[model samples]
Target chain A: MKTNKTSRAAQAFEKSLAARPTGRYVLRLFVAGATARSRQAVLRVRQLCEAELKDNCTLEVIDIYQQPNLARDNQIVATPTLIKEFPRPVRRFIGNLANITGLFVELDLGAKGKIAV
Target chain B: MKNNRPKSTSPVVHLPKCPTGIQGLDEITGGGLPRGRPTLVCGGAGCGKTLLAVEFLVRGAVQFGEPGVFMAFEETEAELKANVASLGFDLAGLVQRKKIVIDYVHIERSEVQESGEYDLEGLFVRLNHAIDSTGAKRVVLDTLEALFASLPNEAILRAELRRLFRWLKDKGVTAVITAERGRDQLTRHGLEEYVSDCVILLEHRVYDQIATRNLRVVKYRGALHGTNEFPFLIGDEGISVLPITSLGLNHKISSERIATGIPRLDAMLGGRGFFRGSSILLTGTPGTGKTIVAANFAQAACRRGERTLFFSFEESPNQIIRNMHSIGLRLEPLVKRGLLRFHAARPSLYGLEMHLATMFKEIVTFQPDVVVMDPITSLMDAGTASECRAMVTRLVDYLKAGQVTSLFTSLTQGGHALQQSEASMSSLMDAWLLLQDYEGNGERNRVLYVLKARGMAHSNQIREFLISDHGIDVVDAYIGASGVLTGSARAAQAALEKAAVLASQQEAAQLKREVERKRAALERQISGLRSDYETEAMELRRIAEQVGTRTFVLGTERAASGILRQADAKVAVGTRGKPGHGRRN
Candidate 1:
């Protein structure tokens, strides 16, 4: 009876681990309008996600002028703000997202120290 | 093109105002801040900008019955409540009662990083929610400059800050936005040029190592305001800004007289005393009984059932009470009865502005009929001479406007600059009493003289100010050959005058007796001569009678013999005798 209980507990732990998504990213970008900075931020974030995150990431770009409620709900005090929503410990960065190297380092998906758990 | 013309000729409309409910502030502001408009209150760090803003909101809620919302960007709600608790503002209670709300908008710079352009719609939503929750009529953004330091986007923050102010105006809420004072502009980001309606600048400056907080109305779009810098104080109560220039010389003048507690001194002031609302100055040298005189005035005011506030800079309250005990002024009883209040502090404890502000606050709270500042000269120790003068002038003006009798004691150093500084505020005084130490005949005496009393006839003579175990005594000025005499010299001179008068009286009596003796002698001689003449006449008459009788008898015997010859001889001798007698007579 004890062997049977231990085997079932191990099987449940393996099943929970298999259900977790691997190397997947979820993001939300907030912008004021289609200004130069906002456009550049959208383009840079899209390029980063396609190149680095590929099909594993889902990105939602919100224009504050059109969707001010969503922006306000998230406390978006500045425009072109990006929020990492998935893969535990959500993070936020406020910029045009043009500095890809600094962005990768801040996103924690660099060559080393990528989020493992 | 159509020329726009008015349909009717109506009077010009003016901007509405909301009263701040602050002492002297509303007067200087002509009413208060422009209603339904944004007012920028910018000041340096710890210069009372936040206090002023919070006070604006709290007063609106409490005094005006208008609800308010305080969206703090710097301090938390609990911190603000604790901070204003000392000011007697129960913000938590107001919040619970739904009369006001304090929403602290905390922005953690480390938790969030700026990526691109965004607006402060979150702050607006939260502020709007608070205002709606209480239907607030007033709103305060305390230390809005904290956002510039917290947030990374300056251009967007500036734009949003402008929009926020405009939005508050659109909401028809009288808003107060506090900002940190900038180097050259009224605000760090030049918020003054954007605010436009009104701009108030507060400064905490250290002059001569003493810090004083001053407030000035930099710009009021369409209102007339006092442009001078006014001193403010943040004490147990909230901010109290003294609008020194708001009060003109239009205060009501009282003709009622109040005693100086010294009967003789009152007599010197034309059988009355200081005017009920007059400003009296007592200037003296060190240890010349200036404090004693001020204490006497306070005692007199309290004895008359009027409240009195005594501000002692050189001595503590206990020291004053104990020292005044020797002079028989029982201030402790009046203090117990709540008629007399003693606020003693060192002159160096605060700047002159702070001292004035504290005095003003106490006066308002105590509502005293009389205020006595013992040794106002100590105020010069806290500030420059000119600054002290300005502070004193404002104090006098405030007291005069309230029709509260005020007494100021000053110490003169007996030199040119000291004299100039001593009489610095004499011109503002309605009555000036000068005390001096008269050193004569190897002793020093306290002498008091009324230097000036406007609109009333006061004694110009200096009196001997005697403070004994009984009370203050003002003896009559003794004028001798050596100018004015006081102390033992006066008594000695008075005794000499009495002796001289007595000696002159004795001399006049002696001369009168000699003249009476000479007159009696001349009268006795005349009487003796008259008596002798009378006796001689009587004897002559008697001899003539006897001779006549004898002659008659002899004539009768001889006339018979030779009648004819005798008759002829007798007629001739009688005629000759009669002619000689008539000629001799």
Candidate 2:
């Protein structure tokens, strides 16, 4: 067990060195209620983050109807707004995550979330 | 201009009114801004837009019993509180009472890195939260256009502004949005597009080194507003607008009479005095006692136990008091009694609007029963004649509406007669008392006459207005051969008349004596003639008696009648010859 713990610590250090120093992406999605558009945005964003980011992103979905304080805190005007909280510059997107590539480009994540097309 | 015009031909929708409680502002807006809609107040720097917005919220909470939320984009809460403290607005107390909510939204251009698209949604959410929390019926976004300076995208700003206005309308809360005036534009971003319900433009212009602030309602959607640019003031009582032409001819009339200080002048006006709440114009040339008349009016008002407000443009309070003391008007006592208030300012100290606003503010605060404006003509130096007229008209209207007597003294330029100047107040005044310096009998004497007094009988005679130790004294009308006389001429003419009467009396006495002497002389002549005739008759009587005696003797000698007859015949022939000789002679 001691040998396995030592190997795991060493592997984690190497992994941290291998990954980019910018760290994982942090994002928040705001919506009015559990409407179809909100659900689609949530599902699509989660799919893209898991598929591309691969456990390298933290996502929080806030329903303005329920947790309006959070939505207000984030300056959410319209439903299904995506806010990129990580990185040096904060960015905003005001639509459902239909065009994943365009969302990545707007969020300054170049080609990271691009599909095989 | 096109936006200002009503769109529909149908009956206009009467928007609900919200009284601003800013004195004349409500009247100018025809009952305050269109209710529950955004009103854009745009002005240049230091034109009082922020003060107006803040006053809106403050007055809403204090006077109207409506809770308000002030979302300042420029000034912080402490700054605003301190700024408005002098105006008697206790913002902190209001906030503590949950009657007001202030949220300062600071925008740091350098700190805000505009890397992606951003909207003013943050401001909206905060404002909405404050409004909801406070249940505010009024909202003020002071200097809202400051966001435009911080943000880089105009398109986004405009869209957000449009949405914000729509949201405010949907919320049904009276909102005042202040914006910076653009060059040749009502607002920097043309915010007038979004706030279509009402738009007020404030202008601060320095004319001849004197700054004058004016406010005009550029567009009021469904209300009949005063289109003229009114003068507004941010004074001890915050924003107060002075409406130039809103005072129509609908003020209530009072038949109550108030005495003028001079009893003689009062007699000239009528028996009692000028009508209560009437506008009296005292116009004259320089040194015609306009100030003295105004002082007397104020003194009389104070003596009547009515509060009086005197606005002297040409003289300071102390100077006026001292000068009036010479005329026996003891204004110091009245002032000490708190019955008279003097507001003295140079006409050049401010623009016409400022003067009007200050006067209005004093009137409102003092709540005087009568107002005296000395030398309103001095205000003509601050603006055009029409502008002065407008200001004076508004003042008169305000006083008339409140049933307060107003006396305005204007200076006439030239000559003794009251000339029709540019702003001829004769037609508007209820009573026009013209004072002129009549040069007659080698002396210039101040003469007073009532040019017109509506709905009352006034003395038409020109009175020699004299100032003595007993205050104003108006001598009786001195009608003479030439016309109405005044000054030393009246006195000299009166003396001449007395002398002529005395001379006529002496001449009558002398003629009477001469006629008595003539009658005595005639009587003497008649008596003399009578005596002479009596003497002559006595002589004739004696002759007749002798002749009779002779005839009797001759008759006794009838025997010798034949000889006598022959002699008588010769005598008859001789008599006939004597008669012929006498006829020839």
Candidate 3:
């Protein structure tokens, strides 16, 4: 029953993303220090924004080591976390973005068809 | 022997501790949790682990002049504030005053899709930021076990948790890490393995359908702490652990004495009554007036202008007041005057620990000079014998330490077991008064005697305990060859003695009258004899006169015959002398 509800909500979100393809996307990626994992997460999120939203997306990379207050104010609990801030329902994606397909589906970017890893 | 050898050679250096400022927790932990180190607090569901951690932070922030940071993983800041608000902790106010900072770590497993290896650097960063912002000396990571559920990879999670604890230690801030208890291990996620400097276990156990919360210091490295499980209560103020067993017998004793309300009962207790600040045990059988004795004690304390608190387990406050009124114990007036306070509750309302905690709270708030627990045996029924005895010991110790005289009424069953059952508790009391029913003459009568009174000369003789409209009257019980008598038997013996005395007095009065009559008869006999003698003498005198006159007349005719009959005048005078000499003979 939980999977069914999520699938229906995902379908609705996909339709809305398709309807407003030109709508601006605001994203924030929080990382800790200059670690390899943090660097990979930041690169992957920037790549997704440049490839998918092109000129309409604004991506901000924040290192919690430098601006630790942002981490406290934003309620960040895990490194390599990506937050879709501008969307009506702000969503958080935690951990390294290795599974590009799952990330696309989580971010509701599947309405633009499957993207190449 | 190896462990003891080192201690004998060198003095042990005490570990620096942070005081929790909690009622008894600090004492149990020998001070608070180890300073500047992470202490693992593990417990099962609804065991108050979260509350204990939160209170550590709140108390540190408000009381110790130390700022704190509360990082809640299970609850948000709003929820945490609202939850602690009921305990009279103004979390929002503390946060606004810059004394505390609350950072809520929201973790939703469904929202987070773990795709690759991730670290908990985010939590570390947030905690570090909160500490730096408020210069917090204390930090609480409430239930870090949520990370096990939020993050999928256990290997990375364990590694990160280990690092987090080490980092918290390096920061030099006292931290409390809460975790869920496991089936066999101390914590479900092996959190205790990481935070091993100190570990506290909280348990919520139900015994005989009553639940009691207990806290135990499972392990503390380089520090001594109470090893026994201490019962704790979450009251209006917060969690208060009862470190009762650890209390020493070193309370300051008061030499003052307080009356027991009944003057005769006081007279039996060395003319002054129970020692002030002493624990008095009043044990009796059913319907032997245990509550009456306790009520009398409370009234006496109140009359002396000392505050008295009455804890009734078997009856309501109003019911006790009404019943005492029948015996002329005016408790309502004392209650109205605020000198007496009554706290009434059912014995089965809660666990023994809760009841004890509530009593402690009442005693602290009322600050009474004397406390009376009516029928404490009923409260004893709420727990095992050992638990009840331990609770009573703690209560007695607490009252004595504060110089508050305490009176505990225990209801015992009929027969010899009364002394046997009270043997454990009676040792703790400074004075023990035994009230029992003497079944004789087809009636049961109440009798009281001072079984023991330490440091004072108390009467060993039993007194007939009488309850009348004018209050308790302690009269001397009849102890004779027929045995101890009370009630109607005592009255009858007194009447019999009075009757014997009256009979003996009447017999003495009758003998006095007889002696008076005998004296009167003797006097009458003597007077009659005297009169007879007088008459005889007068007749003799008249005959002599007649003889003289006849002799004189005959002498005229025949003077010689009269003279011969009467003789010469000198001869007659000589005859008179001869008659006088004859009468003298």
Q: For candidate 2, report its TM-score.
A: 0.69
Cα error, residue B168 of model 1, in Å, equals 4.9
The 10-residue segment with the lowest total lDDT in model 1 chain B: B576-585
Tens digit per residue, CA lDDT, model 3, B152-229: 888888888889888988999998888899988989976654566899999999888778888999999888889999
Over 4 Å off, model 1: A1-51, A54-74, A85-90, A95-101, A111-117, B1-10, B62-71, B93-139, B150-174, B302-305, B364-367, B397-403, B415-419, B476-478, B491-585
What would the TM-scores of all predictions be? Answer: 0.74, 0.69, 0.81
What is the C-alpha local distance difference test score of each model?
0.81, 0.79, 0.86
What's the lDDT for residue B304 in model 2? 80
**Residue B77 of model 3: what lDDT?**
86
Clash number by candidate, in order:
9, 0, 1
Q: What's the best-to-worst order under lDDT?
A: 3, 1, 2
Error of 3 at B175 (Å): 0.9
If both were scored by TM-score, which would come out higher, candidate 1 or candidate 3? Answer: 3
Please write out the lDDT profile of model 2 over residues B1-585, one tens digit for every residue. Answer: 113446587755567877788867888887787778888888889998888887888889999899999988788789999988989989889989999998876645543333333445456666778888889999988876777786666788788888888999999999888888888788777765356688888998876666778888888887788888887777777777766555578878889899998888888877789999999998888888899989988988898899999998888899999998987788899999999999999898878877887787789889999999888889988987777777777777889999999898988877534465723666668888888888867888888888888888888887888888878888875885698787777887889999999999999998998898898999999999999999999999999999998766654554254355565644554344444434433
Compare candidates 1 and 2 on lDDT and give the better one: 1
Candidate 2: residue B565 lDDT (0-100): 57
**Runs with alpha carbons beyond 4 Å of true place in candidate 3:** A1-28, A42-60, A72-75, A83-93, A104-117, B1-13, B245-247, B497-585
Instruction: Supply DockQ values for each candidate.
Output: 0.23, 0.06, 0.54
Candidate 2 vs candidate 3, DockQ winner: 3
